[model samples]
Target: MRLRDYLRINVWLLPIILILLPITLIIFGSSYLSTPNTYFNTQLNDGWSVSHGDNHYENVNLKNFNLGNTSKGDVVTITSTIPDMTAPAAAIMFRSILSTVTVWIDDEQVYEYGKDFADKNLMLPKHYNFISIPESAIGKTITITFDVTENNAFSGISPVYYGNLFELERSYLQSKRLDLFIGIFLCLFGFMLLTLSSYLYMYHGQDLSLIFSSVISFNLGAYILCYNDLFNFIGDNDFYFCIMEYVTLYSIPFSIIVFLVSTHPELNTNLAKVFLSINILFPALTLILQLTNLVHINYFVTALHIMALLEAAILLPRLVMNIYRRYQSRKNSPDYTGMTSDSILIIGLVVFIFCCVIDIAKYNFFNEFGGGGVAYTGITFMNLGALGFVMSLFVFYFYHGIEHINAAYVKEHLEGLAYTDPLTGLMNRAKCMQYMATVKGNYALISIDMDNLKPVNDTLGHLEGDRMIRCFSDILKQAFDGASLIGRTGGDEFLVAIENPESGICEKMIEKLETLMAVFNDADKKIRLSASCGFAYSNEPKLTDANSVFIMADTRMYRIKEQHHEDKLSKFLDDIISGKISQKGGEEGT
Candidate 1:
């Protein structure tokens, strides 16, 4: 097989290894009783009796026992004899799926977990249970009875082990290491998702997919915290633990669906809505049952699990169809390349389904795979599956976020191009009109016309004319860089809107223009540059239209151009008359 195929197989094998390795070490490492001589240590799997809800059984081994959605109260009794009289102390270590447990040794109370049956308040750690053996009970027959009650968990009972006190303690701590490792990994991963979500929100306008992905991650982390019994360290409220589990479990499907919709937007379906409604409805019903004490929540959880399976069955086919349709569409399109979102989502869902199927099989068909009845196989697969789904979702969110940002950038650049003039790189007339139509308050509009642009183009070349227009545009931008708007209104006409300019600034601007023209004419003897400019401002509180002011300024500019034409004509007549007088004088001299 190729390396990638090997990697995939390895990933599937990892969870099984994680579960089995620690359990094997704990079981074998603590198998021998700690003593100066040879001693006997036993796992109390046989000769157990269980009674719950009018049902009774005898000689029930851990493998033969099943909880079966029973979450309220149960009793388990184990009768065993110490084979070695020389052994000093025997201790029992076991993990319990029950929320509350009370133990008695030969009718003498040994350990108590909670106050009473209905006192669903304090919760003992599910990772390990260590019960110390008294020195007085040496060489005696021990009858151990366990009073157990559970909440929303489907896990039934853990096998009991008897060994030396020191050996049992070591085994208890060793067994907890795996759960600790998984919990820490999940918590850190969830925190990373939260951090990424914040960055996406700030930079990418808070994409709903990323936000929902973060929520899903946090919910998963919290669920793991409760499931692995880490929450007992913070607080031992059984009711709160159950409620947290309910909330997290109820929110996961909705959050994932929301994330999916927000990422694709095309995959929104009635089935997703139905799944969301089922998730919400069941949790609310469970809460009502909790409040009314009508039924055990485990039965409700069983129903929810069935509904989840149905949802997965329905959702998986629809998702597959969506992937096929999207793939076909992209295959015909020119721009399609690389892995698509639907493809990634399908991979994730497939992995999740595989893991869930394994878990279901483990829970039903092969419950005694590892000899010890911890049911770690199913739980391990479930957690790994959830993590796989979460990682895939993160991948989707990352790509989706990038696509959104790129699209926004392209749109903004296109808009910038649309409002810009091609020749002069200035605002076009459309932009000018838009600015005039929306602006308020005091503003001055300057209308400018090239005086000799047509003559320059006709006598010289259109290139020179364009250069003149460009020069005028540059000068206008430099003078009115902070103006409200500056744009090319016509071929040789430019407009500028000065925001809140003083009355004297306009006159000073006109003087500056004249000075610049004189300098240009002196430096470039081949061409003379000049322009006629007019400006107007209205500070009236009820100004009707700023474009009207622009019209007035344009009219005034035309009037100035007409006056310059008349002045040039008069100068030409004077020069002609002077030449005639000089000619007449020269003729008299001859």
Candidate 2:
């Protein structure tokens, strides 16, 4: 295949390669290099004990070797022997923890986390920490102990890994690269959508759907970033992190539902409103609670996720039903096309829903697998679905807009043709009548009849007669610069209307017409142009409308024509008697 054809076929792969492929490779490559070694996997589940507040560590061997939920001010100490690995640094990776921890190596405090302002805000996100093993401690027994003062989830500690610090950090990045990419991808993509939407709204037409989709994208990006462990390297403000986490998580579904409603406004039913309220109200309540330190997010994460899943389940089917009904109605219509954005949206939602289900399972049921190798979860699926759906909807919006613009252009052109005079390029009689019927206020009318038009056609051919009419139309337009309407009313007849005409405007127009006729006659000696003109103003009580003004003007025009004919007859008699000119044929008398 040609390069163009190949690219066209694989266009969707571009984003995946650009945004996600590098992270995937890093995950697998690091996992391969960091497979468990004998020294790194040394067992530390035994010889552990616990004590209450303000107590030094004690060695109590427990049957169940797990750090169960530790209350505030509770301390946990684990005594373990470190093998002589002779490594530069040792590290401990916590699969999941909700407590502040302090680690000591051989009576020396190596690292302490989660202490701020006398341990008032002491929650720490799950992460890996490094402990430097000094050269003095190698080949000697080292005491490792940590205190877990608080926790909200898994109230106890699960298995921890003692490994090379470099290898552990590499593994940590590999597992986090997916979420990191997703967070960055969402932020960047949302910004792009906002820019595109602004351009479209300004230039093409306003599409609220683009705006809503951008909102969803930004909300979900923030939601993922709040959970990203990389933030640990940035700050230790647990309260801010917790508030952002809950707030952003709550906003995601609410924004998505809002986007759906914007796309299909017809679906703004009571049921949708209820779903919206749930999505918005719960998160908002949760955010308030977190801000006040009234509740921990772990208390409501499962319920909120269930709400998100339910919202998706309900909203998708309603969307499908709406599309089905619309399709049925349009199937018999002329311009009907097949499935629309709704179908593509359903597919995207399904992808998103599937990923969500998997993530719920990963976080709730099979939670042990986290902080290990990279696991495919909702983040991947959500990104896939959001990109597909938003892109499809954008294309649809532009497509519909283009179709409407083209249709309007065609209609406007047809209307122009209907109301225009073909030969003279002036308004046709139809337009003139319509204008007169709709116009308000005082107006003036002029009725003009071309003189000797039939004689010109007979003597100089029909082409010259047409040229005379065009020249007459141009002079009429130029003379009546501000006329409300001008048209070729009939063969050899023209009419003009001017609104609120001053007393002198009509006399000035007639004088101007005579001047233009004299000028044209002087130049075009072969085809002289002249016409009988009559004018009337409608400001008086007797002439109440434009039609009445036109009738009076037309009557005056015929009377003027008769007077011109009588004058001509007398002039002919004088010319015959004086022998200055000769009348030729019966045509001259006629």
Candidate 3:
């Protein structure tokens, strides 16, 4: 996980928030429990005159009260060690609209009422007696005339406890820059990983690799947007925010291109080209308008952010269809069928995207759902969801890569086992037909017969005759490879198919077979064989064309065989044996 990726993923909070939740409560125990402070020891005398002071204010009117008074506009401070509570997600709610402000031990004056500091970093501080001072009552800095002056003052303390945190953190935490960097790095890292995986898939045709690569790439773009601080360090925050928004929006469309390229039928290289060409110009335009203050909307950059998420959600149904089709084609493996990693990844991304949309809607458009009557601010939450989804994407990709490896293994074994003939170790008729269907353009189908093999099978051992047939098929396979798809169509008959017969592939095969025959029937050999081949070619469809191209070839072969004299089989075999030469010589001749 790189810093950028983490920012991209979390954007608002830490990754391990579930674990951190409890720890947060322990540290900020007082914040969760409605403070147990009783105004006792320090007594209060109502009014005082602070006709002068420095900073931001002068004399101001205030409601007077006693030491035990607990009302609006009361200024209270922690005089002793505060009591600790288990729950951290607690807040002191004032009656009406009062810009809630928090006075932290670190001198961090956070606005609890106004829009500025509504975004919270912690859920609740478990221990500490938080003095709730409503911002509505104080417009100016008044003097602390008496320990207890205002009607809402509480000087002493007593114990109290009301559990269950009411407020949820709605905003993304703008904490340490390091946290943001981690987030941004992780997303970018994921992007890099995705690019690597894409290359792997392109070369090796691995689905998992493509998916993993896509996820990483998506995260990378996201993280780049998240590392706004890094960008700000170089320039302006608003400028940085604009670039981030454009990138975030662009990633949505860009990811669609990547997804299609990785899985689309017929492979859509053009879509990627189109998106790349278009989007390269978009970010610059958006950034320029944003920097010039031309687009001064508070959540101007947010529109694109929401759009990206919406698009992700929209892509899910199409992906589901792809999964269904893939399963139909890959029917045998029911257990490993349909919508694997890609589906899961898309689902997670969609949910995360949707959540982001909600976040934007609540904060900017409408706050109807929950928290702050809009979106809750403070204490990171959505970022956790994003991180969770990212992790899921990682796992999905890892598994997908494994699946590709498994598929390659299965393909290799199947090619060796189910397709190749055991007897001649050549292609069976079924495999031959399959190969024949794939050949394009003008091609030849040939039938070869080894004469005298049947008689030899009856007179000598069938095993020896079988060996003779095997030898002839082996010779034929080597003779017509560039020109042939060879198979044993019968006990003593073999078939060969080749492409682009205009190159004289048929004649070359026959000539090469004759050479192989001579080598096979050496002086030391037991039984010699002679082969007859017949082939036909046509631009227009023959009765079989490619389907029965072999049958037509067989007919021609038989015509040649019948014309020979009865004593010719032995002589023909003798001629083949005598003419054949060394394996090296055959190679050189071919």
Winner by lDDT? 2
**Residue-wise lDDT of candidate 3 within 1-590, one digit each (tens)?**
43223324552443475468546534443334333333211111222222111212212122221123233344433211122333344332211111233333223342333223123211111112223333332222221111221222222222222222222111112222323543565567676676776777689666653564455445544544443333433443433443553455545445544655565553444544564455445555655654564542222344455545544454555556666677566655623423455655666666665666565554443232232232122113335445546655665665466566566766776887888888898888778878767666777787887788878888888898888777777777788777557788778878777666766667877888888888777753678868888887745365545666666787998886775544576776676788644544788889
What is candidate 3's local distance difference test score? Answer: 0.50
Kindly list the per-residue Cα lDDT of model 1 for residues 1-590, writing each as its tens digit: 43233434555554685588557645543534323323445667776666655777677776556645444455555555533433446777666555555666666777765455437433333445567776566555655444555543433456677777665554444455545455566567777877877886788685656667778777776776676656654575655776677667666666766666676655677767776676767767876776676655544544656676777787777768877887787664433434555676678768877886776666654333343333444356766677667767766655454444544665666867988888788888888888888878778888988778888899999998888877777777776657778899888888888888887777777777777777777887776878888888766344468877887888888899898999989887887777965776789999
* Poorly placed runs, candidate 1 (over 4 Å): 1-74, 80-91, 98-100, 118-128, 134-142, 148-156, 161-207, 267-272, 316-346, 364-374, 434-445, 483-485, 497-528, 536-542, 559-590
| Candidate 3 or 2, higher TM-score | 2
lDDT order of candidates, top first: 2, 1, 3
Clashing pairs in 1: none
Backbone N/Cα/C clashes per model: 0, 6, 60
In candidate 1, how many Å is residue 262 off?
3.5
lDDT of 2 by residue, 219-306 (tens): 7676676666555645765456656776777787888788888878888999999988888788778767756666655567768878
**Measured by TM-score, how close is model 2 to the native structure?**
0.65
The residue pairs in collision within model 2 are: 67-156, 67-157, 68-155, 68-156, 69-155, 69-156
**What are the models' TM-scores?**
0.72, 0.65, 0.48
Q: Can you tell me which runs of candidate 2 are displaced by over 4 Å? A: 1-96, 106-109, 115-128, 137-152, 155-171, 195-207, 234-239, 330-339, 368-378, 403-583, 586-590
Q: Each prediction's Cα lDDT score?
A: 0.66, 0.67, 0.50
- Cα RMSD to the true fold for all candidates: 8.0, 8.1, 15.4
